[model samples]
Target: FASVVTAAGFSPNAHDPALFVHLSARGRTLLLLYVDDMIITGDDSEYIAFVKARLNEQFLMSDLGPLCYFLGIVVSSTSDGFSISQEKYIQDILARAALSDERTPMELNVNLRASDGELLSDPTRYRHLVGSLVYLAVTRPDISYPVHILSQFVSAPTSVHYSHLHVLRYLRGTISHRLFFPRSSSLQLQAYSDATWASDPSDRCSLSAYCAFLGGSLISWKTKKQTAVSRSSAEAELRAMALLTAEVTWLRWLLEDFGVSVTTPTTLLFDSTGAIDIARDPMKHELTKHIGVDASYVRAAMQDHVIALQYVPSELQLADFFTKARTRAHHRFHLSKLSVVDPP
Candidate 1:
């Protein structure tokens, strides 16, 4: 596949090897290949068509017009831009689990402890369901936190762990929900970094979460537990900011490779004033001395103007949704901010 794309004057993207870009004086076209399936997109329709024709000539390929469906994800064009959803995928999961008629859950409840209940008779089913839900999370950022939590217990899942499957029921209600990418938004990168201090009762590890936006459309998000225990909230927040900075830096490079000039420093919003201070000031404080190299890494990025750290109040921290479960109102607000909406 690499040779084929290279022969056609397309170079593989550095950040994502599956992506190939053909740059020309007229315009640029992007070709993304996942195994045999490929998605070709570009500003020049004629160039895209030419690439499709070339691919068909080289190999047995079926050109699916306009990309309505691919790999279980459904794409719909809107007045604004595009909406991506997994409604059909969600329904198939419901049917496979025999929960098509089950009542949907409004919010996730992941307070399950390892000692909460007896182990499941068949752990395979639990693992399978959780794995499937993890895939469903590609376009469903709302369920990312819950899915991350549930995946942790895959080794020895119990009844309490299985209860996290309520997220599937929640998906049933908003099965048609889609993420909208606006056409008129800027291409500048903006990101939010947040952490929940000592979120796990089993371990003292904190939870780090971040969401990156390109031109008002969400491009990436992550929810994961921190590897090391932190002494203070500032430490946890700093670690989260470091992770966000790494992601933003990679994304900036990706945009530059796509011929998009990311002239401005990426904006990184954090709810921790102390973390921001730590990142901006080169001097080490008593609270931050014990911090690992991640703190220094973030500070250097800030110094190099790779990222601009700004303070955001806790309530407006959009990454909060990825770090932990929130109130119904707050959850809805974050979803709206990410442009994840149900079809009317």
Candidate 2:
């Protein structure tokens, strides 16, 4: 199959074997292969049709027209931008599960979340809820942090049902809210990385979170707990920056394959000045020798001009939405910055 695509003039992307890029005087095209399924996209309509015909000659193929539905996401384009949602999947689970507004009581929810407490009677139910929320995180970045915290207790079991219920209610109310990508959004890549020191009382592991943006629209974000404990907030911040820098490098490579070459240095925003100093100052490494690898990786990225580090104040740090729970005002502020449209 790879040979056949290669024969059709598409060069396999080094960053991802599943992706292929075709460049010519006519235009550019990108093909992503996933087992039996493939998505072909490009700016040249004629070349797109030709590629379809060319691929069809070697193997039977069906062109699915424009991408309206794929991998559970429902896409709709408008004059303003594109809106994508897992509306069908959300509705299906809501109908089958015990999360319906009519059935679930409002008072069951608690204001503050607790990581450890009395063991849950039904651990399987907690696990299932965690799994569902994990799947939902594919389109719902707003729930990523909470879901990440809840998942840690799934194996040992702890307070969970009410937390899951709260998330379900949010999904129910914002069923129509969808991810929006504006046509006029910038093509340049920008990213945010942040970490909270000693956030987890149970293990003392720090929480690291980062989000990538394609112009104004968000393309990727993650919430994770560091495997090794950091001695200070600066160490945690550097580790988080290291993770995000690697992600940005991969994304840049992926975009280049898609024919959207990012010529300018990618912006990596963080709230930690100590991290910035550690990555920029060679002498600072003597003080941060324990985190040598992560510090060095970031420093090399800066030296090579792959990324430029900027210090955003903690209050304005958008990645804060992923590392810790926030007030309603803060949540909306970060949500809007990510270009998500909430349902009224």
Candidate 3:
């Protein structure tokens, strides 16, 4: 496959080996290959046709027109741009769990411990359900923190853990929820970085999360507990900013393959003025010396003009949603920003 693409004057991206690109004076062509299936798009229709023909000659290929569905995501086009959803997938999951209840999503603030309640007679179903929900999270950024929490107890799920599956109820009510990507000519990158400072009762580890956007479209997000315990809120926020910088760096390189030039430094927004001060400060002191290398890495990136740090109030921090569960009103407020539209 490598030789085939190279023979056709296409080179695989250094950041993502699965993506191949061919640039010419006529226009640019890009191929994103996932195992046997591939999606090809470019401005040069003639070059696209030639590449499809070339791939067909080597191996039989079925051309799915306009990418309506792939890997369980339903892609629907709109006048603005496109939206992707997993409505059917959510329904199937609810059926498998034999859950028919419906309601708005509530807080995932349940304080579950490993030793809390009676263990399930069979843990197999719990593992399977958690795995399915993990896949469903691909297009469902709203459920990130819930899925992240539930996945932790997969090995030894208890009856108490079952009560937290109310997130599925919310899914049933808002099945048509989709992630919309609007068309834009701007080739810019920005991200929101946030952290929950030592929230876990079991361990003192903080939670770090970030959301990355290209132009006006959200591209990536994550919610995960930090590997090590953070001593202060500032430390946790700095770690998160460093983490987002790494993602933004990779995204910038990936955009270059699509012929998108990110001329300005990527904007990184966070609520921590302390972290921002620590990142911008040149001198190191005894108080911050224990922050490890993450904070220093962010400062270096700033020096290179790869990223610019800015402050945002806590209420507007979108990544805050992924860092921890919030009240019903706060949940809706944050969800509204990341999820552009909802089911009518």
lDDT of each: 0.84, 0.81, 0.84
Please give the range of 10 consecutive residues that has the lowest summed lDDT in model 3.
99-108
Candidate 1 lDDT, 59-115, residue by residue in tens? 998877888998989999878788899888888777865554322233444566778
In Å, residue 103's CA in model 2 sits off its true spot by: 18
lDDT of 2 at 84: 81
Candidates ranked, most accurate by TM-score first: 3, 1, 2
Model 2 lDDT at residue 322: 87
Badly placed stretches (over 4 Å) of model 1 are 44-47, 97-110, 285-287
Query: In candidate 3, how many clashes are counted?
Result: 0
List the RMSD of every prediction in angstroms.
Answer: 2.1, 3.4, 1.8
What are the per-model numbers of colliding residue pairs? 0, 0, 0
Model 2, range 78-114, lDDT digits (tens) per residue?
A: 8888878887777765775565442121222123335
Task: Give per-residue lDDT, candidate 3, residue 287.
Answer: 63
Which pairs of residues collide in model 1? Answer: none
Candidate with best TM-score: 3
Higher-ranked by TM-score: 1 or 3: 3
Instruction: List the pairs of residues colliding in candidate 3.
Output: none
